[model samples]
Target chain A: MSPYDLLPRFKAQYDANNQEFSISGVVRPQAIDELGPSIALLRDAIGRVRGVLYVNVRRLTQMNNAAFHAFSRIIIDACRARPDLKFVVITSSVVGWTSRKFGRLSGIEPNITVEEYDSEFYPGQGFLEEGGFVPILRSQTKMTWRHERAILPRHGMRQGIVMADICCGIGDFAVLVQKEFQPSRIVALDHSISSLNYARQVMREFDIRGIEYTYGDASEMLLDEAQFDLVTCRHSLQIFNRPELILKELYRICKPGGRVYITNEKNSHCLGEPRAESIRWTYNEVAKLFGHFEMDVELGPKSRRYLMEAGFEDIRVETFMVTNLDGDPQDFADVIAAWADVYAGEMATRRGDGAEFVARFRQGFQDHIFAALHPKGYAGWPIWVASGRRPQ
Target chain B: MGPVQHDLAGEPTFEPMIQIDMEIKGFVSAWRHCDYVSTYMARMISQNRSDSVRHSNLFSSAFNELLEVAFRTRHADGELACRVSRHGATDRIELTFPCVPEERQFYEEAVSQVAGTEARERYLNSVSGDLAPSREIVLLELAVDYNATLRVEEADGDVIRLVVDLPLEGLQH
Candidate 1:
């Protein structure tokens, strides 16, 4: 009789190296009840044979609070006895809407890991399981430090240019444009109300007004034709499923001589630091699952050509090698870890090897942090700032 | 009952029932040129204090056409009464017309006889081109939901009741 008899649809097995253990399929509380003790015994024995145990639960269909707590206790207690051994829980949220929105889970020690991967791989440094990775990725005060600073100074964001920002993620870049550039008026549109709510909070924090924020599809804007003086999307263009339709829409809305400023990464380099390499490797795999809407990820690298294809004149592309190490190396790791987890859950549903790959890849992120803190730790991240002008 | 929704910062949320009951005095009052009664009702339904953007936008669209139908019919006097209420958290726009008693059968037939899928599709394809959507197509399209209806509930005199109960499920964001 198979150990997962009660959970006929599920499978729990060890990999070739035993460094990674995977439990996949409908992982309900009753199923966990049947399999929990054997898994706990395996967790206890894991420390004796291997220095690490990567628990890939990314493919679980449903895990209730009690089952999650029970499994968490097993890992936390086992890791408690063997301080040198590490236990990392890699999960995917793509199973369903309610899946993977789990509360933070960790072993008693600080080094134990529980990573919830978001499908959209926004930028981040790695994370330490100890603090449960609640790092604020967006900051209004320190807005100028990242990619936007490279494109800001040149433009005359005069008092009369009606601007529109599509996919204004959390409105961080839009706020910067409104404050620094000072356009006459801006209409920010995004599909997600939750994100816009956060953006509205940020606007209140700045005490600024006159921006019209609404829920709209970027490709099919509800606004009148050629109404905007400028249109900008930062770190958001690559995520659209129908970029061609949207790019054409952007072209249609731009006023003569007005520009469309779009920014996203063509290359994400972490100074060849071992840790940075690990995060990027994991990021690339996770991004493959949900990031594309029916488009290629190659679009980010070839945005200049896409602009030309979208029929924009006087297209200009700028590559800025943004280099900074002001933050702690561990903080960098934590941020990257946070970013890595963004898609693990979402991707698990796409591939048969998803849970296993997510765990192995996260271990790579852990190794990157350990190596990045070395004396030679350094990283260089790149931002491709592409702009095109509507014909005069 | 309207879908409960949170509001923008500083903007207040909507009550389950609107405090002020709105009355559209006459069919001519709404359809006579482009005037207050239509605009008033549109604003009330569109800017539902509830802040349910999807519900407000979609419901207002269907009601505008329905209100237009209320007038264009023959017996329509300027005398009309409309109450926007919620059915236990369900958002519905209820309009009662003191229609010309003679043409009551016409409005009744229009509501009772709905076009089928092919007829509805043909109706849509016909009037889809220009901004003009025919009365038949509009009524048929609204009936697809099965919630929107026109029924002649003859009481003291003969009065036509037009109820558009917008399903929150169909209102996809």
Candidate 2:
């Protein structure tokens, strides 16, 4: 059965409650609040059943600590009242919370069971829902496609060398590659110490071994001449102030006959005027630097072209269009809220009514992003991904 | 894995469980109090534990090793001489630096650089009542004796301060 087949079952079970209920779910307080009374009633009913109370909450993009604590308290109280009853919680894996903290929380109660499902089922589900910018290119579909099409095949050949993933936010690709391909050694590199810590915790919780995690600037850290068979970077190249310098560093650390995989998201909005100029600068810098090496390039308006420009051989770019029926006004609001927190410091320093400006921008941006996914709105933005290999 | 032996003092000498737990606790505490110097120092000491069996009490041995490492390394010069004063169950660590006249001037410059105009003005206003016209007259009196070097360079009439290399000897533990 598809992972989503359980959603209706969860809804049906949740709807059948008639008492004060405590609902323990991941990444959504607002949605829980909307369904509060029904949830409370369900808790009361579940208290009487003497059977296990399993709650499967999906599509939560963000939640805060207070909300999480409140959710935990609800479950604790329910368990306290019904010692015979077991509480099972299934969370979506979109925001990368399958770490030691989550594991500890899952095992908090002896009778409680907590399980985390991956991005395939929980796209756009996380705690940073409304305030942070979820990169348009790092969507679940795009990441899965990249892994299935490129990462797995390359590493599955019993390659003796390790794979270095630079600027690996949350270390999803690194962890997935290690698990699926079983590389000799995997080094997950990210600048943020917090991200590396989280990645380490995830690795520990999942019992994933043979991976070394480091926190440092990729350019500074890649100064070591140790060559790797594969160097993969996805959705992280855009933020670098010096893409060419980084590309040179990538080439320096890659072994002879090794391949450097670069993936990025391209949209008309990002490629217009100032942003377009920035993209052009990076593209030109990459072209010049990679020209010295045995390289190939692919260019498309979507994911395909961005990879091609980075000098990969046997170029292939595919656009995967994803549509979510759950793209409601609430989802838009959540995205806006998440983006606000991220841009709060920057927005505060700017002139004019920053809150109002952000609110409007978020609403408009949400409408635009969802328009493509919605039949009634504009077609979803085309996600372009391309791959090429370095010649031996 | 043999009979977990204890020392004559009744302390677990070869208890792997106790050793691993101590190590894990040290690691966890390092992550917990990552912002504090003492916690970071503790973490550094914990990380130095190798498979070699040694004949020293854990705390004092760790402290001595750390001291040796700090003395030998570049971080020693930057080491703030921390005095640990205990009161009942609580311990307070006080760090004091001796400020020479040149170092004072450099400190003032650094403070000014950080505070900017508005903050400096506010600070001056707050301390206006304590200001005396000839208070800055004594130079030698303001000089302080400290182990760390206070390097100062003149930059367009501004004092630019630099911290000298520190010996990282005390971290050996």
Candidate 3:
């Protein structure tokens, strides 16, 4: 018997009092055959609730289609019974919304509400649990950072210029543009099939027309160069092992006088130590790439420097300081863990204690680098944004 | 029996009950500015269930508090009224309100102002002094229905609250 069988207890408690209910249990995959039974039990549990059911589906990094189907059947059945039941579904990370089948599953039921909870939901670096923080952060960030910063500024009527969003994760920027700008055409490109599927689903739900979602490597995609009026590479630049090649592609695709906005997380180089050397190396490599192109550049103090070095002209850089100490200690710990995981490959071969060494060094980095550096007791990363125009 | 309190029980006189409920529901649904009102209401209604009459009174009071805090803050002339009546073992709360023609016109105008052009541009300029240079104004038009109801059914001591006729509309102004 799987832990999903325990859901009946939760259902009974919920029915008896209608109190806000929470179920915490571990799911072990016994075999390929056992997966179906486990999913059935979980679905049965979900069907018992009539009110708002917030399903936190975690440990889904290894979930396959059969597992997803099982989960979807349960959700579909629940929605069919009580259309008013609002289902809030959370996933670890969503790769593509426009191309993935599961991403489109939210559209299967009008009553089921699905949203991707990524870095925006966390206070600083914490994974948000139920009743922990506000659920609106994901929506707010999309409006502020993705919409206000990228989409709203560039949309217009009768403009021949089209937009190509490289690595359009979950179609946040793409959806905002399609809905707000009503652009002549938009090509949303992402590497993950799942993210593309979700993006497509959102577009369908919003009834947004004339947007195309493509699933392929943004760098290798056979797109016509100089066809786009604007090329946006939001938060996807650094992930490329060879960012220089990607920059070359961006330059080739952008029309003369067209603009490119690149945003990334700035590694802490303020520590003035071995960790600082690694940060400096990363920035230098990025700068060398931009030097090849004849464009003006602006360098932000944080992650915004890479755009300046990429030969972008009339560059603007903005620095955003975010702290991750708003919630419990465990939340901060989780953030540290995630940070370590993200940079583990790079941090492992370096010197001592891996990320912990870098983290500890960051604590005293300001004192060594800048006399004016304020030493506020907090744990968070600083993000930098840089935008530049290609010369005509 | 003395005054019959404006009795037109069967006259079918445009009982603003559905209209009022719909207006409140519309206001709540139109703007995705808050959480689900039914969920919040259910919690409040369940906690205040001391007796049938007291439960109704408390439900009415709590519902009004939610109305004032959530909907009244946005509109200047917003009105909310609630009446509790017992039908045998079950109790129903009916909310009513007088129609405000000016406010309705104001909303229609506001929607039109942001219709063709970027809606966010107009909204930002109206609300905040700073103008964002971006022309892309993604405006999700608030969905407002003129008739709706929130039914709370009690079966076997389990209270199931359902928000009916919740009109969902998407507008890009």
Best-to-worst order by TM-score is 1, 2, 3
In angstroms, the error of model 3 at A374 is 17
Better of 1 and 3 by lDDT: 1
A106-168: candidate 3 lDDT, tens digit per residue: 555666655554424212112122222222323323423532444335321224458777777
> Once superposed on the true structure, which residue ranges of model 2 sit more than 4 Å away at CA?
A1-161, A269-360, A369-381, A384-392, B1-173
Summarize candidate 1's per-residue lDDT along A168-211 as a digit string, tens digits.
65666677677766787787776555566677776778777656
Q: What is the TM-score of each candidate against the true structure?
A: 0.50, 0.38, 0.33
lDDT of 3 by residue, B1-173 (tens): 12112243662222122112334445644322112243234334433221211222223322432232234233333334333332222234433333344533443344344444454334333222222111111111111111112322222211112122221111000
How many angstroms is residue B154 displaced in model 3 relative to the true structure, after the best TM-score fit?
Answer: 69
Candidate 1, residue A270: Cα displacement in angstroms equals 4.3
TM-score of the A-chain for all models: 0.58, 0.47, 0.44
Candidate 3: where are CA atoms >4 Å away? A1-161, A269-311, A322-337, A340-380, B1-173
lDDT: worst 10-residue window of model 3 chain A: A121-130
Which residue segments of model 1 deviate by more than 4 Å?
A1-146, A153-156, A182-184, A197-208, A267-270, A274-298, A326-331, A343-350, A354-360, A367-376, B1-60, B70-173
- On residues B1-173, what C-alpha lDDT tens digit does candidate 1 reach at each position? 55424333662333344322223353354332212243345445543222233344345445655666655555533446555655533456556766666557666666666633354445334332323345555566555432454444443454676655555333342
TM-score of chain B of each: 0.62, 0.19, 0.26
